[model samples]
Target: MTDQISDAQFTARTLSEALPYIQRYAGKTIVVKYGGHAMVDERLSAIFARDVVLLKTLGINVVIVHGGGPQIGKLLDRLGIVSEFKGGLRVTDEATMEVVEMVLSGPINKSIVRAINQAGGKAVGLSGSDGNLIQAEKAQKTERDPDSHIEQVLDLGFVGEPSAVDTSVLDALLKSNSQLIPVVAPVGVGKDGHRYNVNADTSAGALAAALGASRLFLLTDVAGVLDKNKNLMREIAVDAIPDLIADGTAAGGMIPKLETAAQSVKHGVGAAVILDGRAPHALLMELFTEHGAGTLIS
Candidate 1:
């Protein structure tokens, strides 16, 4: 009986601490790029859905953009399709694009929507192609040869980047009194009627900027950006991000995530955070507590 009473007291105190944050974020929009281990682990996924629903219950508009690269690859292998990567992006041909869309828009998108709905939230699953939400053009990349410094534009077939984002559908759903959460897949349609596989991080940043979101949260595998000694850097100025990349502090997949975060902040999103998705309730802790869960770039 005494322990039960103490637990109740702790819950009340926690709620009291979260009150200010709840009020601060009410009626604002936040974009979350949900991926990494959180998507695969059942326990983590359940808690993530609950956290998102809690945010919605508090009157915060939340947009979820999800990735399914591994799933897509697995399906492609099962179907006997060969694929490769260029500049860390899958070289998506027509056949590969079909599978990419199948995985991202079908199973992954619907699963997240189902999880949120089961958690007592109304979630609408959408692909970037739905309602032309994300208009894209073929992406062009340049790589220099290591032996000789010659830069050449490499054609990444059917792989595209977001050129413009139309938020009318999202705005209608969010503004409606019914309180619908939008879960978007990153498969975009090109101007020429071809479906393009877009990077989820890029799509989330673009959508956040277009919506003028209050914050953009990228749930990644790592804790956050780390210093040379591998300690988490809690805060980073937007302008200083480039130096981190040039100096090798941020390399590999982290470079693109940082670039997206910085671009989102510069283009109109209030701020961006890169936090570990593996940690349960990291999103909630980041938003509600004084000390956020990850590196903040503003």
Candidate 2:
């Protein structure tokens, strides 16, 4: 089967298939939350950089918001910091926040920016702290007691959600460089001069909503979403999410991704997609192909 079609035929077919998508999103903004294995694997990371360059060259506004949970954990372990989690939110104390800021805003952010630049795209690295791009409030959680079954507020220190996203900086960057891609680190600043560690997915969703982006991509380890039977569900509606979560089909970290996607859609972004970043050129396939790369929630 592979020998049947020549390279020229494949190229032509791919371009023809992508024409409509390119037209639909030629000047639209796309926010991608890049993480998981895709961020760690060198080969996949290079491919991602090329794909981002391709998207920017095609006239799309590409904003990359990334997660460094695994990286952060590794650093914490190296520093002998015993980390804790409450309701899936990291217990980011002042010390942990320091490491988080350095890791997210320093190495991780610049690396992605450099990758895109090397791939022929103008790229900038930013943290929410820069220009107060993302103003956040301390995040709180509630958990039910197993014995008393009473809800109690749990303090998840230094963890925050976006209260406001100021896109002026992003606008300035975009205006100055038509093909610029911004790689954002999910670190926010509070009004009180405190730095907060935000969930990458939530941060990306907030940015997308604020920008009215055409799509928000949550690039994960899994292939889009799977049913309880482990079959891929190509598309989901915002209203259908609660039921899916209640029934346990949407489990673990995926629950938060879906929540972010639904919120992004409701807040004005066209759609939010959960796609497998482990797949080569997954982001490209999601944007430019007839058969998309993931499960879309709109």
Candidate 3:
């Protein structure tokens, strides 16, 4: 009985500490890029859904943009479609694009929406092609030959980057009488009437910028950005991002994520955080505590 009473008191104290943060974020919008190991882990995904509901209950509007690279690859392999990657992005052909859309816009998007709904929150699933939410252009890349130092353009068929984002559908849903959390899949339609596979991090940054979100949270697999010694960097200024990339502190998938976070902050987001999504209730720890859970960029 005494231990129970102590636990109750602790809970009360924690709530009291969170009151100020709750007030600060009330009525503001936040964009979350959900992906990585968190999507595959059942227990963590449940915690994430409940945490999102708790944020909405506190009057903070939340938007989710999710990725499904592993799922897409798995389906493509099963169907005997050859997969290729150039510069860390999938070289999507017409056949690959179909599978990407089917996985991202169909099952994965609905699963996330269902999770949130089951957690007692209203969630609506959407694709970037729906309502023309994301306008995209074919992405291009160049690589320099080590021996000749000559740059050659590589063609990554249907992969695209956002040119513009139309938020009318999202705005209507958020402003409706029945509040609904929007879960977006990152398959965009190009101006040439082609379907393009968009990187989830880039899509989330664009949406956050268009919506003037207060915070952009990227749920990643790591413990946030690290320095040369592999120590966590708690806070990074937007200007320092370029140097981090040039100095080799950031590489691989982390490059695009850091770039997206920097761009989102520059475009009017209050801040952006990249933290470990595998950690249970990471969102709550970052938002409500004095010491945040990830590396913050502003």
Give the per-residue lDDT digits (tens) of candidate 1, residues 266-295. Answer: 999999999999999999999999998999
Better of 2 and 3 by lDDT: 3
Over 4 Å off in model 1, which ranges?
none
Candidate 2: tens digits of C-alpha lDDT, residues 129-178: 99899999998789998899999898989999899999999988776347
Report lDDT (CA) for all predictions. 0.94, 0.92, 0.94
- Clashing residue pairs, backbone N/CA/C < 3 A, model 3: none
lDDT of 1 at 41: 96
Candidate 2 weakest ten by summed lDDT: 172-181
Q: What's the count of clashing pairs in each model shown?
A: 0, 0, 0
Those runs of model 2 whose alpha carbons end farther than 4 Å from true positions after fitting are: 1-5
Worst 10 residues of 1 by lDDT: 83-92
Rank by TM-score (best first): 1, 3, 2
- What are the TM-scores, per candidate, against the unseen true structure? 0.98, 0.96, 0.98
Native-referenced Cα lDDT, model 1: 0.94
Residue 297 C-alpha lDDT in model 2:
95
